[model samples]
Target: MVTIETPRSPRNRKSAQREKQAWLFMRASGVVLIVLIFGHLFINLFSGNGIKAIDFAFVAGKWANPLWKIWDTLMLWLALIHGTNGMRTLVNDYTQREGIRKFLNIALWTICIALIILGTLVTTTFDPCPDTSVASALPQFCK
Candidate 1:
């Protein structure tokens, strides 16, 4: 026989609504991630000159454009948050200890926020022209 635990309070209803929203978000973000991830791989690894073409200048050139910057930023933020939420769900389900589950979730969010902040800074603040020792082979923008 299967047992179903029923919610007994109004707070449970609010939690149920949030849970539904999270489920929807997971589905939507997953679909978006498929496109974003595949497009990212194809563009970075298959298009243009291919894998051998990736270098500091390649990254700098790519981030120089606001379009690619936004693409990458969206990809990073979506993937991180989606992954964090999934992990939180898992922890809530699997961990029997409330204290342990809470600690894990707190750690997950802290790491997620830190990564998002760092990634956004890197994506948006990237400068195509940076002072390098090898000025001879530098892109014209750097010269």
Candidate 2:
């Protein structure tokens, strides 16, 4: 006979609380992501020369602004975290083997962290104007 856990039980309560928090986070992050994504699309596609204006120089010019940098960084961080969390929920639900589940979770987090670090570095340290003898190769904004 299977026994059902009581809602008031300490163990059940803790698990329930964690699940509740995760659920709330998913909803909050999803809403924020929608706003961020739409804003990004509007700026990149509708403004200036429209989609045709997007080139290496366009990206370099945008990142030159601290505001854009912050906006993009926030978007990157949120997107990665949101995706990782969703994947984690799937892994938890579908994986039956403890060893495999643990491995998959660890792998997922490790990959997410690596990508976040790489993306943050690229966004923060990006220099559109680099010292080079080939001036013609640089974006027009750099010249």
Candidate 3:
């Protein structure tokens, strides 16, 4: 003979709720990431001179706009977090040892946080037209 556990039993409620939230977050973030990625690609690859037009000055010009800065920042944050969360889920599922699982999760989050911080700083504080003494080194648009 076998016994069955109820779906909403007290013992399972907390984990169930957390899992539900994670599932919803994954779906929502995936959809948003698709839009952000496509928009990024369209603007960068299709709008202007295509792939050939994506040199330093092109990036500098784009970052000059606050709107583009915000857009890139959003894309960076969402992509990093979304990927980290998915990897966390995978680590939780596959790693059998508790110690290893904990260590891997910590490492994953640490890398994710570090990358996010670095990427955000670069995106927000990027300088397209640096004040350099050398004139020829600068792009034509900068001059």
- By descending TM-score, how would the candidates be arranged? 1, 2, 3
For candidate 2, write residues 7-103 as lDDT tens digits: 3443477887987898899999999999999999999988677988887678888988899999999999999998998999899878889899999
Q: Which ten residues in a row have the lowest lDDT in candidate 1?
A: 4-13
Give the range of the ten consecutive residues with the poorest summed lDDT in model 2.
4-13
* TM-scores for all predictions: 0.88, 0.85, 0.85
Residue runs of model 2 more than 4 Å from their true location after superposition:
1-12
Per model, state how many residue pairs clash. Answer: 0, 0, 0
Please identify which of the two predictions, 1 or 2, would achieve the higher lDDT against the true structure.
Answer: 1
Better of 1 and 2 by TM-score: 1
As a whole number from 0 to 100, the lDDT of residue 16 in candidate 3 is 76
- Quote the RMSD, in angstroms, for model 3: 4.4
* Candidates ranked, most accurate by lDDT first: 1, 2, 3
In model 2, the clashing pairs are: none
Q: All candidates' lDDT scores? A: 0.89, 0.88, 0.86
Q: What are the per-residue Cα lDDT tens digits for candidate 3 across 1-143?
A: 78764433433788779877988988999999999999999999998889988877788888878999999999999899889989998997788898999999999999999999999999978876787675465567778
Query: What would the per-residue lDDT of candidate 1 be over residues 1-143, giving only the tens digit for each residue?
Result: 99877733434778889988999999999999999999999999988899988888888778778889999999999999999999998998788888999999999999999999999999878777666777764566787
